[model samples]
Target: MSVSDPLLKSLKRFVLEFRTTNIVVTDDNENLAKLCSVLEEIFQKGIKKSKFFDKSDFFWSWVAKLPSFSKERCNPILSMVIDTVKESKKVTLDLGRGRLFIRSALMKKVLTVPVQIIAKNRQLAREVYYENDSILGNEILAEILQSLLFELTEAHFQLRIHNASFLDRTWNLPIYKQYELVPCDNLGLHVQYINGFLLVKAVEPGSVGEENDKIHAGDVIDELHGEALRGNKMSAVHNILQRYKGLPVHIHVIKGYDSQGNLYKPIHHLIEDADIDIATADELLQVKKSTSNGYKKPPHTILNEEEAEEIPVHGSEGGASHEAHYLGYVSLGIDGRVVRIEDSVQGVLKNHTQRVPVRIELTEKEVLVIDIKDNKTLLQHAYTEISACGRRTDQLQHIAYIAGETSCSLAKKFNCYVFEMKTNEEARFALCAIAQGFERTHLLL
Candidate 1:
């Protein structure tokens, strides 16, 4: 469908609702008759997915706020709409065939953002939302669409973490100028159709590469590790960045350059960490410990509930209530706004399948010890399934045994993991590890 189809329908519906007799035959008599005919056809046709089917009634509550609209006169149309959508078993089956709905989550698309039209053409509309929140609704469609759009627009705002806070990039000199982004968790050093952002977590280590030189926990991250600070896709630079933890990246005061330059800016000089007393103290301890997940060599390892208990607390504070705050963030790069995990539930739509999170981020910046959180991270991690099969990431053959199905294609479609209750502990860990951080590749065990 052409993109204009959506706007066209809105146009037709808006005209019809004006009920101006001079424009057409908008008479109380004609309206009542047309309304009846329209209603009859709708019930008979079962609400065809029309280009002109203005779901006005769905958002009519907000429309009602308009002064010209009359609740009394609009009753007939509203009544007819309600009766039409109030479905019977056969009607629902015919309407929503092949819909993969999650239990308790299937919601009517009823939320509407109240936006005042600006400018003459009404082309500029801004959503009205509370100062503290974004104009997002609780639906997968909104999640995907809004997130995609947000990222696309956000990519334009080049971020600069100009924290000359740390004065130590003694190693090989800070490459603030040689800027590029390697793929991160869901983002590869080089990837296409990136759904997440160029998540840059850096710290300015006091020391250098050596543990002594290596920036400590309190160091401030200078560059997004030398990224141009984009929420869009750019492959001119390298695609993968690894061993990022415990490394203090240099800060380059990179200014946007001519498109002709290939975005290569020489590293800027180091910024002094003048008075980082407060910031330094705050940086030492994360608000909460991250959901720590790593196992000894022997892949597919498992340290289930019983084994996990003995793990001691890392620091002194052990009984804290608030652990950490983590939120799922996706970036569409240039596309802006979060796109739907196009195939979040790709379990062979016809067959059942499973997938695991190669990496789970329970905390963005927190250090909760096992004793303090009582393994809450593990609980949340356990519930974290490979919710969606990404663009082309596939599964492992062993997953076939877990799913007990001959074909793996089913699970491959949704980018999900398949695990069994009867599996051993090691198998569980493998799935968990992939869910935590599938480095260089996605493990499909």
Candidate 2:
């Protein structure tokens, strides 16, 4: 039989789990030879004497060599292999979920093969065996052994350790910067605690932080408003920001990159001794309390009763709406809004997959797609017209929905509208809102 035939048969008969088992073979030639001998016996039994052989044929033949290879037999073989390599002081075995992941404790190299335990009747069992790849020749076996042992030897480990220590001692340097930032729209800074410092993860576009040009993502905020941020919880940072709301705050940051623009070594290398602190409810409550009392309208500030009543707040009773900025429809060729569809809107969109800036708004009864620059409604669809709406997983920051064209009855059809959001989280939120709109419409019906 051809190689493809038996491989197809095996796949159809048994579910091939792509899970792996890792084993670290010793650098010793004697142990490697013994392991190769055992593997050769299995491969010779399965492979027919032929000039040409494929992976599928080799795999099936190996399986046939141990038709009754059970969990009991699997453990002993793995233990024996482990014992043979134990003298190297680099063997580590991780067994779980009927799988094994073997690797050298000191090296980054790894070899993965399926080690599943199945039944004699060609049926899958709860266990697995390490079976894949044929022991074709001594060269192949020698190559595999060499890869596992190349950097795992004692001499290599000692040399690497010495080099790393020398570099750390001689090249370590500190880079710092100070910024005076005025708070605008919540400072627009999102931070995460990493390596004992509050690392700025993102800076919101158009915010004061971004406008400053000095503050940036990846910079570690070592001190905020005269308070050292290191060894402090995120809540502490929040509390400090809240206390100094609407005021220019002084910030001292340890630059993630050096003066030469190259990233610092500590940013990429793990610091084993850094302590990561977890936030508690008390800290969260303190942040909320500080925020509530942080901002107060000036004594001269006053609002008319009508002005107060007319001011729109999101999610309010008077038809409040949700809006998000998106890189507009991929199907639309032009950057501007589609004010009128002289031809088929679907046809125009289907012609190309280009994106432009747009603003999406969800109102009481309709969804409006507007051009960001012109501020004109390009396309409007009622909740009832929407056939489907969802965020695309393939493009994490993209959202897609199918809606029927209400205008131009001559060629009325459903168009797939695709828009890319600023972030995946925003895309997900937009999808959820669209789903809620559908649900509300269903309830009204």
Best by lDDT: 2
Tens digits of per-residue lDDT, candidate 2, 226-339, equal 676656788887888766543334676655555445555564332222232322223323333443466432111001111111122226542333344443333323211111
Candidate whose TM-score is highest: 2
TM-score of 2: 0.24
Badly placed stretches (over 4 Å) of model 1 are 1-280, 286-415, 421-424, 428-445
Candidate 1 per-residue lDDT, tens place, 256-338, comes to 11122221121211111232233222332321122112222212211222112122212243211222212122322222100
What is the Cα-based lDDT of residue 156 in candidate 1? Answer: 18
* Local distance difference test values of all predictions, in order: 0.23, 0.41
TM-score of each prediction: 0.16, 0.24
**Sliding window of 10 residues with minimal summed lDDT for model 2:** 299-308
